[model samples]
Target chain A: MIEFLNSIQNSLIYKNFFLVLSGLDNTILLLLISLPVGFVLALLFALGRVSKIALLSRTIASYIFVIRGTPLLVQIYLIYFGLGSVKFIRESFLWYALKEPFWCGVIALTINTVAYGAEIFRGGIQSIEKSQVESGLSLGFGKFLLLRKIILPIALRKVLPSYGNELILMVKATSLVSLTTYMEMTGIARKIMAKTFAPVEAFIAAGILYLFLNFLMVQFVKYLEWKYNPHLRLNN
Target chain B: MFKFDKLVFGDAGWGDEFLIATLMTLLVSILSMGLGLFLAIITVWAKLIQNKITRFIANFYTTVIRGVPELLVIYLIFFGGNAVVMSIAKVFGYNKYIELNALTIATIAIAVISATYSSEVLRASYLTISKGQIEAARALGMNKFSIFFKVISPQVIRHALPGIGNVWQITLKDTSLISVTGLVEIMRQSRISSNVEHSPLTFLITAAILYLCLTTISSRVFKTLELNYSKGFST
Candidate 1:
């Protein structure tokens, strides 16, 4: 059994197992860049969706509709290749940033997640009881203050579970960054598989990494959920 | 203003290729949705009526499929499908290289993803059916299969149509990912055109617009289905 284990470990394919460990950096970087940007955009788009003004609401609706309707792969291709084709963008100061696959991927992922997150937030906002808004008004709160103190907090708390799912999705979606030439986990896995001809081991490793990230995200979201749930805390 | 001239039938434009690709996209999406719906029915039935083992199997299927990214699922199927098929064939003493077509691969991938959503919808619809109604049917001497078709199935379809429509749209959008496997769907065709013409913006924009068109038409159809299904149930 010890000899068998040594043989498994000594396989030429397993020699570079540590290379996959370095891939976690790219994975973490992609998540760190995309998540906060996605959150801000989601907030703006959600506000636009629930805005009183017809034009603001309609424009946001169209943006959300179009983005949600299309596949993220097409969006990535369009931003990376399509936007890159424009002479203005090519010549602009932003060209340097756009040239990097990392930034390009972050841009695509941020846009896709914003669209989904906005919808989730909008649903949460819509589901908020009108009596709460009335109470906020009775407390002499203006629209902005009410949104800040009451509406936004409740909406965000309510939407946290779904947003947690979205976060996990973004972790997995970062695999597509490989298409843009960013050597994230899946990208590295593909390379390793190509060299060693062991697709199952490489892919299985990548899948485990993804599952691990998702498991962490689930735990983090659960902590946030517990922290925010006043009723549960009061009982405890 | 957008002009139809570029979209008109001619060799100079993408009109013919786009049309053909759109058809292919629809074909793939419909085939996948049909397969998913069939799988979902069995899964829902298994989860609802079968033993604990069957229920566990059904739950495991849904949980794994839903938890993973659709892209990963597609990749797994794309790479592994042919090998698995060939191995199965070899066991039967048929060792010739049987090429799994791109459409079949895409259909299976998308169907596997769609089945999770479809099964969820079916299970929800099943739960929404009143238990008393089933008991009444049984009391009236209706067998399980007979009662299921005559009562439960129609109502479930009616209730599940909107959810199913959402799944269809999702499947439609996901077909764009099949380009990775070299399928000549709209997205793939557009990518080819973009590369050849060096006009990525125009081609990608056109592709996005075509997708919007498909989704908008589908939303309308789903709305009509919802209305039609609600006619008798609502005042």
Candidate 2:
């Protein structure tokens, strides 16, 4: 049984298991670091979109437009190889972080997801009934305070489900970092495939990892939905 | 700060290459999107079918395709496809390399991903249809094929337009990943131009702008289609 299990074709998984698992560290790091930063930025953008200032809202809207319109891959290349090549940026203090391919990827992923998440948040914010805002206004709450206290709480909760999809998207998107030579899951998988000459099996392993990650994210979203909105919960 | 010296037409510039690449991106995206919509309908049908195996396959297809990254999907189709072709040729005793075209592989990859997403949209739109409509169709003695053509499809289009529009935008942007397979799309064109001009930022910015134009215009078309399809439906 052991001999049968140790066949040449079957050795692919056990052989490079640790090498591939190391890649997950980068992938998880990308997800962990970028997501919080993206959430804050997405919220700010969403607020700016709803703000009364025409110039501010318009600027934020265009920023979101540009981000959404471009491919995440192109955005990564623009930041890593494109912006990273600039003389001024290279000379600046920002070069410390920009010099790393992984950081470039995080920057791209954060910006891309912020555009998408901001849209989802904007939809959530806009869906808030006028009566709620008017009540806050009538209660003498300042605009910023109301937004910080009430609007954000409700809007963020309302959009949690939609935002969950964005989370899964970001998780999958971390795979693109591999293109920048970041040793994420996809990158490691690619190397293994080349060495083993078994592209399908390599992809299957990576694909399974991604699916597992996304499945966890989906469950996380469901838990959030259940936790945050208790009324929607089913009681035994 | 960004140079446009390499953007102008003639021997001095890559303006022609950029134009051709943009067209290629559009062509590939359109081809994949059309095929994806067809596949999505089939997937939706499979999911809706009562057969256990068909439903499981359809569900698995959507779930796995959605869960995995586009890069992986593209790589698998590109390399695995070549491997399959080579193995088949070996089986035929030819003993030679047989590779699939990059364009075909890229299109298939994007088509597959888009189909899963669009299938959900299509399925949701179909399910939104009230049970009464189908019951009425049956009462009218219409067969299954006739019922779908005469009843379900028109309503599905009306409800599915906005979602389909979103899928189109995603599909259009996904064509950018095909550049990795050397499909000569906008992203690859920018890479080549940037290398030649030694100004990656300018060419990339130009590429971003072209994509912006495509996205904005297609969105407008979809908005119009949504309006047209929704006509006579009570808001």
Q: Write the per-residue lDDT of candidate 2 for residues A183-224, one digit (tens) a residue.
A: 899999999988888888888788888888899999999988
True contacts kept of each: 0.48, 0.85
Reference-based TM-score of each model: 0.93, 0.94
Over the true interface residues, superposed, what is the Cα RMSD of model 1?
2.4
Q: Which window of 10 residues has the lowest lDDT sum in candidate 2 chain B? A: B94-103
**lDDT by residue for model 2 over B20-91, one digit each (tens)?**
999999999998998899999999999998999999999999999999999999899988888777888888
Candidate 1 DockQ vs. native? 0.51
Q: Candidate 1 on B86-172: residue-level lDDT in tens?
A: 999999999999989999999999999899889999899989999999999999999989998998998898989989998899899
In candidate 1 the C-alpha lDDT for residue A190 amounts to 76
lDDT of 1 by residue, A1-236 (tens): 99998997886436545666678899899889899999999999999988899999999898889998888888888888888988899999988988888999999999999999999999999999999999999999998999999999999999999899889878878888888888987788778878877766676666666777777888999999999987868567
Off by over 4 Å in 2: A1-10, A137-145, B85-97
Per-residue error at A102 for model 1, in Å? Answer: 1.1
DockQ by candidate, in order: 0.51, 0.84
| Best prediction by DockQ | 2
